[model samples]
Target chain A: MTNGSLSEIYAKAAYPLLGHGKRNVQVLKEALEQYEGELDSDMYGSGKVIESFQVKMADILGKEAAVFFPSGTMAQQIALRIWSDDQGSKKVAYHPTSHLEIHEQDGLKELHHLEPTLLADRTRPVLLQDLREMEETPACVLLELPQREIGGQLPEYAELEAMSAFCRERGIKLHLDGARLFEVLPYYGKTAQEVCALFDSVYISVYKGIGGVAGAILAGDVGFAEQSKIWKRRHGGDLISLYPYILAADYYMEKRLPLMGRYYEEAKELAAYYNGCHALKTIPRVPVSNMFHVHSDLDKEQLEAAILEATRETGVGFASSIREREGGGCYYEVSIGDRYAEVPQNALQQAFQALGRKLRHTAEL
Target chain B: MTNGSLSEIYAKAAYPLLGHGKRNVQVLKEALEQYEGELDSDMYGSGKVIESFQVKMADILGKEAAVFFPSGTMAQQIALRIWSDDQGSKKVAYHPTSHLEIHEQDGLKELHHLEPTLLADRTRPVLLQDLREMEETPACVLLELPQREIGGQLPEYAELEAMSAFCRERGIKLHLDGARLFEVLPYYGKTAQEVCALFDSVYISVYKGIGGVAGAILAGDVGFAEQSKIWKRRHGGDLISLYPYILAADYYMEKRLPLMGRYYEEAKELAAYYNGCHALKTIPRVPVSNMFHVHSDLDKEQLEAAILEATRETGVGFASSIREREGGGCYYEVSIGDRYAEVPQNALQQAFQALGRKLRHTAEL
Candidate 1:
């Protein structure tokens, strides 16, 4: 909870709500200590440590090979370019809320000349029916497992199978933006290999859920991986050395990879508790992948003030931040991790009760 | 010298010739150790250390702002893209041997749709007369200072000034691929600022002569730097942390930057000695920078065998490899650094004497 970015939150949190991953500086320190016997790493990206990390990730993802990138933004763009070039079409289909479309500042179009077509609605997971309805076919279809922007909702397994078959029949390549794949696995109740089997390529973030410093992994068949290496050099994703990120990633993967199941279990219980509060509501009413939308009737500023007052007076945290909801009022993205998992039911109830007392004078919430 | 790729040469060198940059792992270790008292950098690329380094570079290059990139490939590509977009023309001009043309595998054309026009002959520096005779102006004219592949030669200072003025009058952007800017300054007898002032953008490699692991700096006016940041993010040149490269560059700049003058002086002396040999000839009969081309009457394999035997018997190494020359025999790029600076004049004379003796037995001459 006290990693450099989270230190501000930790200092203020009477109890910090767990998020998608860990950010504890002390824990990171302990993680680096695990590399005790290691001297250092290679001059550039290739070395025993980085190679072993990539091999382990490849095994976990059930891909023929995996290459580490300094940024997911670069990896995803390169993946789309590869698929699009092979098909001789620049068109790629993605959800309106996909990271490539929104977060990357249109790099796909501006840098790589990739044309992205928005599929389905921004509020829900993309469906097979959505693809069938398109006027033109795209060279690739990119699916974000447990879509993040809409509070972590995944398509049903049968629906996903239908969509995969549809893409295969059309000869359209499928790629997975599996940044949150590890955390979402417990809900899917399947191995990573099973989920990735439907796609030609998959990209996972090293830090999003794995608690590495920063890096991304793109995995696929041997040919795709080999070709991506050339693009990686062109895009400047090849670092002089990746050992620091690999060491941290290896330590956390060993410690946290298997613990996602328990984290998801605790998340559902916590969502139920949040729903019990009259001022707050969870989006789906049931947790899917340790995350859901949290809404309050108060506007952004008032809700923030109330939370601050509650924390000041009773030393309890309600949420990280509140922003104007799409419909009205204020909302936040609720993500549960180890910190929230450790909070006792009675203690959480007290936290909500204290926040309620502070918001009693507010009319909206 | 015995890092990874350099181990083969290090094991054989009674004394090895420096080509391009440092590969000494011990020096790299010392560089990393300098940051022992510093905490880890900011989450992304905006820590105090990174900021200071960028500021220092901007000051040295006399630019309004400077940005550090993970690789020179990203920096140059982004710079070309920016100039092309601003000029509303997709054409960029360069010498036939430009790194952007030959080394980057035509990424400009394939990735960004920028058309490259080879403006001048490969045997000599790009002259203003060449641009004047062109039927159409290019979006950007990229000039490499003391062009790396052409035995490190630069245009006359007056000719460079005339080219800058011509581009300005024509509303054409000019960029400098000053990857070896620091080392080439002595030849021009001008500060980096004086040279960079003529171009709209300049890129310098942190590792080429500065001895960092790997990184590059792109500097220009305020607006250009701001625009380049977006491209930097889009290209994935932005890293989670750049403090290691920053720290290493900072250390080496302090230690190595001032010594370039001596290296250049010694390089001239070494070239003079090699030019004296009957079998080996130095390009231009003198070195403009700390590097020159050595063309020998001996073919590639013969040159390698002679160098190996020379090192085995007398413990003096000439080069790593010899490439087939277009005309006949073989040629290699010889770059001088601190290691070469330490060798006495008599030793280099003796080494060249031995090479000439071996080449005497060859029929290629």
Candidate 2:
């Protein structure tokens, strides 16, 4: 809600595939009300429906137990706090670009009073070399799937395994900020459980890719999950009833989890089309997930207006608003979803073509 | 979710009122769907309806601003942490029965590292002598209105004023855990703002007396309230959308807040009826809020079974489960609400008569 971000996000919510927005009321209402089973009691975020979803998530993620929370920020923070407490170290490692470091306003430091050991370069995954270079041991190493900050790029599997081994050999905790875990699972070519086995705890977003209304599931061993619930209650994320989010997540996970491979392929196709343009470039020539970013030389506001106008005129939402990048460049993310997959690539290409001509015309004007 | 508390709570939720429950789904659904106004944009706890409710709450509490949270546990903990950080001291004083101390799983200490300076007796409100006897300065003094743990007991307004003045002179913050603020306001015969004027900050439960499904409002000066939003985000209290809770809170506050006086009177009438019983006792003898406990000489489980059986036998539900009190007494809370408000006193008295008979029979068996 800062600096009118809520209103800005609200403004964007009016567009479908608003560059991958997960929440919409009509969509959510239909998703929720269509449930045929009993609307289970919403007590402490547990019930047959809520627990079923949580267990399925744990099974998929290959963890022993799981708990749902109102937000991932709370889940990730709690996971870190639990690991720190268990390992008896207040220091934890995460990329500078990690959601906890950037979006959470230094919650790890201010709220938990924990020291953060910044690991690796911000542009990519945490390499083993980064762990070797740290001055002091951290209680946990936090990893985000596909490194959302830099266009959903992930390191090679062997590289991640070495990083895991590095942390394991030192008896440090391994945690995953898997907000987009489902989106990037295809890149690993392994089951979520298989990928998750290397980590001590994993936090999955319900709304991001799975298209639940809003919530998260943190998976780990029973003890860790139990501790996370306590932390969740303490942090206010222990909502009285999480049925709406849980039921929605269950439906969406079942609906969307299987489509990730196609979405990933669509991302590549979309990125290939975007890169063919003279002024737009995809950060990773190939997307490691169902998402990629299009860095544009065009002005951000202008590009957003053009894309939005094109969306309205042609019903082809090529992208959402453009985010101005550092060093005077502007970019917008392209997250391929079921909604985005519905539009023909030719329709998107035409929208981009019109956008380029419109930008050229604006330059002429 | 602690020590299977969630499961236990869930088990209790199967029956209406669990003897001290706050919300239900059918009621919530009807209340939510009947809302005729346009659904506000799902934002970070703000919108026309949400902000309007927040501003109205601030006005009612005599504070500069108010922010809504999904849970009171989060609101109070964040409120304490904020006051502690602002004063540069972590030690905070409260009665042993304060929600933060008893129910929050040491979040104030574990998450915020704030030292709790326990004060006063658990069975009664904090007196001036308690503050006078403090060994060291504290960052804040937390008080719960008509303390829920003690069947909603409140100190004399003058005593509270003295305590507030003592903290004011010492530059200590005074935070009120007013989870049932509305339910108790009639006892003081003061408006919410007038009574709230004594405290530096106050947290009111939207779900408890107001009948919303779940959420809380932490009210304070402009700076404190503004800072709370940041803390809320950090703690994962800031959800993508809190419109449901906010809208429900708005509707319930409007529908239920004005009934406090009548409910307060009803509680007195009900307590008078119960105190007239042979073995059952209303702790305060007179009502302080719309709630009080009925302590009985019978066994806890036997009393609970009798009440449930009575509820099942008669269409009227007169009471809820009894909690075994300290010193071998069994007790249960009677929180008067829309459902309980409808039952006549005669019906309730007869139910108790039947309960006594049932208990006697069980004793004989």
Candidate 3:
């Protein structure tokens, strides 16, 4: 039998559990089917469609206003830049593994000429103590809940409150990188508004856990939102028409938000299956959100082969690819969503058994 | 009888003589229906959807590579930044009315820290003489063909060739702001590639003159295009999915590109009708493209009322809005496209007649 790439193999499977579904135009088509709003396109962020979505997001986040951006990268950078400009300090602080520091090609530094201060070690979530210990005062402090790079880990709500208060007391603006905000809410037992209330500004990805095609919402006070509009134009985030994104964001938020709790439960169960394997374990030993990292003592090639074997035999796909760990072994992030619940229980059990068997063989080596 | 705003009245008319049609989701719906390509979403500017379109655009522009951006603002700025960085110069030059200088909230200045030198007076297109007269050598010179702000006027092709040679000889990178590139091609008797040949880099707006929802293509050498990808991500122009824009761009370019000559002819005929009226005259006195500005001796209220009366009576919409001229009177830009030809010839004549009669009555005052 021919061996295809894992993603190719997963794509052909009966139950490929990951995200809401495949990233395709079908996602947009499905979202459009659910959309009951206006058909008119927005012009450079104007008109009813973009405005209504912005208003809805702002209300849900309990901010005075909100602006929609084409990407979370632009939204987050502009949010920090605005705060930095207002404070007359160019320094901003965030976790070492923050999207700005890693993913954005130093846009914050190169484009905006703002200095970024990495707050803590890359392996853990930033704590309140990390803020208090900073030698230099930053214009803004950014916190990404369910720290994605480290494996979707989040600090306690009480700890978040203390950090928020500490930042507020020191006249530092706090911004939330809530790209996977909805995924973390079930664990916090807080509404999006309650969680957002702790930060001066918040940016959320509509495309991440929400299963929208692509877009983001940046929420803050009236003035901040207004300023973001100008920056949106400057960044070219203000496309002539953003209604498709707005519609999809609106549709998916409605469809999947209520299922966050269920997805969280599914994630825990799935992680347990992985842990049952001889060489496999999950980071944090428990998931705080609907996503967690599955690590294996086996190298990437061995882990991939085992997952592929399980997927092909039982028709239950695990992951498309695995990342090599710094020390040794391999890992992959498991993000639970609509697809997770659709995996047949019996097939899932068989797939895990197959995976366990392969790992047992590897452990014997 | 209750009187509505001119745009409100125009929107209700049977033949709104501007653009391909309405700017709505239906544009996307129609484009999607015509698309026979892959439905897979591009993840952060990867995948076949975006890649194929970029390749197609690069081929059409005769460039080694191309990059798609959410807006022309981002594409143009990045193009200029790359040129400036390569030349180790921060100064770039463009027409006084360039979109980068006027419409982009000083993004080039603020984000990239590039200095802009306005090359010529706002009322006219930049001449080669103007380039020769400049004291300081700029890293790049941006030339907007059929410059939108000055009523879509263009310099002679020979002048363009001369400027291109002079810039090349002086180590100044020449960039084309070809937002309305297709509209001017009929007049220049040049293919897009031929026109783009003079410049080191080129940017085109798919939305304007092409009637896509929104997007821009920046094309140049392979290395330049590769660097733009990084800048695109930095500016957040690299959205998770841009297939909708790509599909629409592809669909409309196929539909409308060959019809540029027809639109150009219609524009001239329409401009003649305006000039025939007592108080109306078109900028250029003769249109060199599918777009031109219609100036009226009448004030804003007078002009709007007269057009509103003609639109309501004849069901042939002229314009939705008018802008006040610097000193006095008012004017509006007419961009002829699919909708212009759809207007019945007889109805168009009568509409202009009504417009002329109203202007004559006002002139009697």
Chain B TM-score list for all models: 0.93, 0.89, 0.97
Q: Kindly list the per-residue Cα lDDT of model 1 for residues B291-362, writing each as its tens digit.
A: 888888676777676666665555566776667777778787877777886566677677777766766655
Query: Which residue pairs clash within candidate 1?
Result: A44-A240
DockQ ranking, best first:
3, 2, 1
Tell me the lDDT of model 1 at A159: 91
* Best by the lDDT measure: 3
Give the C-alpha miss distance for residue B334 in model 2, angstroms: 1.4
In candidate 1, clashing pairs total 1
Interface RMSD of each: 4.4, 3.1, 2.2
Reference contacts preserved by each model: 0.38, 0.47, 0.63
TM-score of each: 0.88, 0.90, 0.98
Off by over 4 Å in 2: A1-22, A35-38, A298-315, A318-320, A342-346, A359-365, B1-24, B35-40, B45-49, B301-320, B344-346, B358-365
- Per-residue accuracy of model 3 over B1-365 as CA lDDT, tens digit each: 12348878878899889888788777887777765433778888889989999999999999999998889999999999999999999999999899998899999988999998998886789999999998899999999999898889999999999999999999899999999998899999999999999999999999888899889999999999999999999998888899878888999999988899999999999989988988999986788999999998678888888888888889998888889988899899899988988889999899989988987887787
In candidate 2 chain A, where is summed lDDT lowest over 10 consecutive residues? A1-10
All candidates in order of lDDT, best leading: 3, 1, 2
Better of 2 and 3 by lDDT: 3
